[model samples]
Target chain A: MMNYGIIPISHLQLAMSIILVLMAGLVSAFLKLGLLKSLIWGTIRAFIQLSLIGYLLAYIFQINHFILILLIMLLMCYIAAREATRRVNVPTQEPLLVSFLSLTASSLLVSVIVVTLIITPRPWYSAQIWIPIFGMILGNSMNGISLALDRMYNEVRSHTAEIEALLCFGASPWEAVKNSVRKALRAGMTPTINSLMVVGLVTLPGMMTGQILAGADPREAVRYQFVVMVMITASAALGCLLLIGISYRKMFTEDLALTEDMRQSHN
Target chain B: MEVFFQFTQITHQFAPNGPFIHASGSLQPGKALAVQGPSGAGKSTLLRILARLIKPTSGTVIYQDQNWQAIPPRYWRRKIHYLPQKPVMFEGTVRDNLKLPFELDLLGKEGSLDLDKAKLLLTEVGLPLASLDHDARTLSGGEAARVALVRSLLIDPEILLLDEPTAFLDTETGKKVLMYLANWLQNKKNRGLLLVSHKENNLAFFPGMQAVVIQSEGTRG
Candidate 1:
C-alpha cells in the first residue's frame, strides 16, 4: 500500500519484475535461444525509461501549472507530427506542416471539447486529467494520419493509369483522386473501428484498467474510458481527413500534373 | 500538313545517368505513326512523355507551334489521350464507363451518354449491345479493351496515343478495331493516331503510316 490509498509495488517488490525476467531468461538459456541478451537489455531499457517518465510526471503533477501543461501538450503534438510525417512518401515544401496542422487542430479541438463540455477538469488545463487523455488521442491520431498518408501515396502509384485516364478525359486532379482518397480514409479508420468493436469484450482497455488499478471508482472509470474512446475515434477520423485534404495537393502541380516525385517514389 | 505535335531531344531513364531512351518525331494531322520496339524499349514511356503524364529527364514537346510546358497540362491532355498498355475498367456498367467523360466538368456540358451512339460503337466493334449493362469487371480482356478505346473516343481527342490496344484481341477483332479507328480519323480531318505495337501487320491498316523503331541505347558515353 502507498500514500494515495492505492496498492503500490514497492522498489523492493521490483525484485518481482526481475523474477519474471529471470524466468524468461532461464527458458531462453535452456532452449539455446539467441534472444536472452535482447530480453535482458529490453527489461533494463524499459525500467530506466518508465522510471524517468514516472518521476517527471510526478514532478509535473505536483506543480500543475497551466502554462507548463499547455507547453507539454504542444511538445507532444510536435513529436507526434514529426513521427507521422516521416512515413509519408510524397515530397512537399514542408511535410511536417501538414502533420502538425492536422494533429494540433484535431487534438486541440477534442481536448477543448472533452475538458470544457465533458469532463470539466476543474482547472480545465489540469495536467493530471488532460495530459494522459490528450496523449492517448494524439498518439492514435498520429497513427491514423501516418496510415492514411501511406495508403494514399501507394494508391496514387498503383492507380496511375486510371488516374491519368481520368485526367486525360478532363477530370480535375481532385476528381481523379477522389476514389483513391476514399480508399485511404477507409484504411485509416479500419483499425479504430475494429478496436472499438472488440474493446470491452476482448480486452479491458488501457485507461479503464489503469483507473481501476489506481483505486478510482469503477463506474467513474468506465465513464472516463468511454469519453476517451469517443475522443480518440473522433480525433483519428478528423486527423486523417485533415491531413489528406491538406497534403493531397502536394501530389500534383499547379498545372494539374502529377509530380515526378510522386510517380517515381514507390516505383 | 502542319505538324500537330513535335518532340525534341526527349530523353528518359529509370535511374540517374542510366541507360536512357531518345525519341524525336513529328505527327501531322490526318497521318498515322507507329512506334516499334521490343519490350522495355520505352515505347510506352515515349507516348507518356508526349502526353505529359511523365516528365522526361531532358526534352520538350511542342504542340501547335507552342511549348507544351507553357500550355496547361489539363488542356493539353484534352487534345492528346494516352491509352496505357493494359486497359483499365472502372467498377460500373459498360454504359457507365462510356459516360465517364461526361461526368467531368469540362465534358459534362457535352450531353449525357448517347445510347444509340454507344450501341452503334458496340456493333461496330462486334460487341453485343446487351454488354452495355454488364458489370465492367465481368468483361473479358478483349471486350474491356474495346470499351476502354470507345470511352476515350467519346471525348473526341485530336491525337490518340494507343499502346497495343489490340494486344489481347483475336485477329478478326483486331482488324475490326483498326478499321473503326480508321473510320474515326476519316470522320475528322485534323486527327492523328500514334500507335505502339510489336506486330507489323497492324501497320497495313494505316497506309503511308510512318514507322519509328525504338532501339535502346545502352549508355550515353
Candidate 2:
C-alpha cells in the first residue's frame, strides 16, 4: 500500500548532514546553555562510530565466515554487558559474565531457531539476517536486564529490614527475595509488552520502516516484525530471570547470613 | 544443663580497622540475658550475631555443642527467632502476619495456620480477637511489636532474640507485655530469651535473668 523503494544517500549528501548538527549547536550557543561543545563532540563520535561499523559490516558480509560472525556477536554481547554493568549502582564481579551468558543464551537461541527453523536463510550464516536480528534482540534484552538488576538491588537495599525479617522467620535467600525478583521481572517485561500494544498504531517501528525502504514486501516485513517482537519479549524475560537468579546469590554469604557487611559490600 | 548456644568473642565493626570492641557472650536454656549498654555500643549488633542474621568479624557461634557453621541458617533461624526493634508490617490483616511462618520452607509442608492458637496469643497480649481482622499497616507501633512477638512465639523457638520490643509501648502496656513474656518463658523449659533494652532497671523484673553489659570501648568518646 505504500512506496517500498528508497533513494540511496550519496557521499556528498552525507557530508551535508553536518549543517543540521551545526544548526542545533547554534541554538545551544544562542541560549548560552554551553552544550555546543558536547553537541559537536557527540556528532563527531556518532559519525566515526557509524562509519566504522558500516565498513566493518561490509567486509564481514563479504566473507560470511561462521566463526567471524560468532566472534562479532560475542563482542557485541560483551560490550552490551559492560554497558549494562556501568549503568547499575552496585558493582559485582559477575555482571559481565552474567550478562554475556544471559544475552547470548536467550538471543542466540531465539535467533538460531528463527533462522535455521523458521526463516532458513540461505547458507544459514547470512550476515544480513544474522547480524541485524541478533543485534536488535540482544540490545533490547540488555536494557531489560539492566533495569531489572537495578530494581532488584534497590529493592533489597531499601527493604533490608523486611527481607531480614523474612530470613529470620526461616526464609531462604531465594524465598526472601522471591517477591522482589517477580517485581523485577515484571519491570523488565513491561517495556516490550507496552511496545507490542501500540506497535503500528503509534508509529512505524524502525525495523519495519527499514525493511519497507529496502523494497521488502509489506506482508513479509510484517511477518519478520512479528517474529522479532515475540523473540524480544522472550529474550527480555529470560535475560531478567537469569541475571537476577544468578546474581542474587551474591547478596548473601555462604553461611546464608544477611550481614551488615554484606549490605555495605554491595553498595 | 546443655549449653544451648556459645559465642566465642564475637566482634563486629563498621570497617576492618574501625575502632570498636568485639561483643562476646553465650546463652543457655530456661534463662534470660539482658543486653545493656550505652548508645552506639553495638547492642543490636550483638543480638543480630546471636540471631545468626549477622556474622561477626572474628568469632564463632556454637549451638547445641555443634558449630553454627554446620547448621543451615534457615534451620538456625527457626530455633532462634530475631525480632527487630522496628517491626516490618505487610499490607494485610493481622492474621496474614501470623500466617507468615507457615509459608516458609523451614516449616515445610507440615506448616499450617492455627487460627485458634493465634487468637489465644492475641488475647494473652491484651489484644481483642477482633485485632486479628485489623489491617497490620494501621496498627500502632506497640501493637505491631506485640504482633511480632506473637508471630515469633507461634514458631516456638529455643531462643527468642528481642530487640527493644517494648520501646514504643506505654508504661502500662510495656509492663503487661513483659510480664506476659516472662510468664510465657517460665512455662516452657530450656527456652532462652535474649533481650536488648535501654530500660536497665527493668532487667531485675525477670527472675533468674543475667545482665550482660556491653561498653563501646570508648569509640565514641
Candidate 3:
C-alpha cells in the first residue's frame, strides 16, 4: 500500500487560480503600469501553452515508443537550437547548425549515460523517463550554449587588435582567441555553477519540488535532484566546450587571419 | 640584390560597392619599400595582405622564390611580420610581451627568447633598460610603439611590415625608431622592410628605398 498519495486538482480548483492573475492585474492598473493588457495576454498564452503541452505529454507517455521519443527529443533540440542562436543576436556563419550540434551532442551524451547507468528504467528508452530527462538537459544546455556564443562573438569583436597582433606573431587562431574563449566559457558556465553551489541552501529546484508535491519522500526526491543537478552541470560544461571548439573557427578566415566581418564593430 | 618579398596586382575593396585599391611592389634584401597613399586608400591593407593577415581580392605574393600559397600561413607570418599603426599590448610586463612570440608552440626550439638581444633592442630604441619590467599596457603611446617595434624585431622575421611605425612618437623618438630600423636592416642578411607611412619624410631614413603608391578609385554608384 502507498504511504502517500498525490492530490488531484479539479476543473473548479484550476479556475480558482485566475484570482491570483486578477490580483496582479489590479496592481498593474492601480499603478498605471500599462501592463494589464500584456498581463492578460500573457496569462492566456501560458494557460493555453501549458494545457496543450500537458495533453501532448500524456499521449507520449502512453505510446512508450522508442523512435517516437527520439524524434520528439530531436525536435526539442532543434527548437532549442533555434532559440539559442536567435538569442545570440550577432553575425555568424551556420549558427543554427553549430547550436544544434552542440545541444544534441552534449544533451544526448549525458542523457544516455544517466538513463543506462543510473536510472535503468524498464525498457531503457522508456518514454516517460527518457523524454523528460532529455528535455531538461536540452533546456539547460541551450542556455549555456547561447550565453557562451554571445560572449565569444562580442569578446572576439572587441579584442580585434590583440587577436590580430597574435596572428601576426604566427599564433594559430586557437591561440589568438584562447583568452576570449576562456572568458566566454566562464560566462556560460557561471550560472550553472552558481546554481550548483546554492541548490540545497538557497532553493529547492523544480524537479525536487515537483516530486515532493506529488507525495514522494523528501529523501528520495533529494537523490533525484542531486542526479539532475550533476547531470545539468556536466551537459552545460560539455555544451560550452564543444560550442567554442567548433565555433571559434568561424571567426577566422581560411588563411588564419581574423575574419573581416569580425573586425567591424557590431554595436 | 635578390628580391626578398614581392606582391603583384594586389587588389581589394573594403565594401561591396567600395572603390578598388590596387598595389604592386617588391622588397630587395637589405633594403626597404615605403608604401605611400592618401588616407583611406588601403595602404595598410596592402601590408596586411603581404603579411598574410588579409586575403587580397586578386594577387600573388612570392617570397624567396616560393609562392605564398605554397607556404603555411603560420610560417609565412613568422618569416614576414606585420606591426599596426596603433600598438597593441598584451596583458603583462614588457618582458612578457617581448617573450610572447617565443612561447608559441609553432616556433618549437627555434623560438626561444633572447633576453640580451631584447634588452639591447629596448635600449637601442631609446627605452630605459628598466622599462623591460614595466607593465606594457601602462606605457605611453610613444613608449608602447617602441615596445611593439622591439617585440616584432625580437621575432627575427626575414621582413618587417611597418604601418606608420612612428605615428605615435615625437619627432626625436621617431628618428630614434627609424635609426634602429636602419641599423636592423644593415645588421642582417636576407632581411627586408615594407614601411607604410603618410609622411614621405620618413622614407628619407631608408636611403635607396623604393616607393609604391596606392590610389583608391572613387566608389561606383
Best by DockQ: 3
B-chain TM-scores per prediction: 0.94, 0.93, 0.95
> Could you tell me the lDDT of residue B105 within candidate 1?
80
Off by over 4 Å in 2: A1-6, A259-267, B218-221
Better of 1 and 3 by lDDT: 3
DockQ metric for all predictions: 0.65, 0.80, 0.82
Candidate number of the best lDDT: 3
Q: State the lDDT of candidate 3 residue by residue for A46-158, as single tens digits.
A: 99999999999999999988889999999999999999999665565688999899999999999999999999999898988998899889899999999999999989989
Q: What lDDT would each prediction earn against the true structure? A: 0.85, 0.82, 0.89
Q: Residue by residue across A1-267, what tens digits does model 2's lDDT show?
A: 666477799999998988999899889999999998899899989999999999999999999999999999999999899887786655543677887888788888878888888889899999878999889999999889888877877777777888888888888998988888788888888999899999999978899988888888889889989988888988898888888878888888766765443365322
lDDT of 2 at B43: 83
Quote the lDDT for B96 in model 3.
Answer: 93
User: Which model is ahead, 1 or 3, in terms of DockQ?
Assistant: 3
Shift in Å, residue B1, candidate 2: 5.6
Compute the lDDT of residue A45 as modeled in candidate 2. Answer: 95
**Selected candidate, larger DockQ, 1 vs 2:** 2
Candidate 2 or 1, higher TM-score: 2
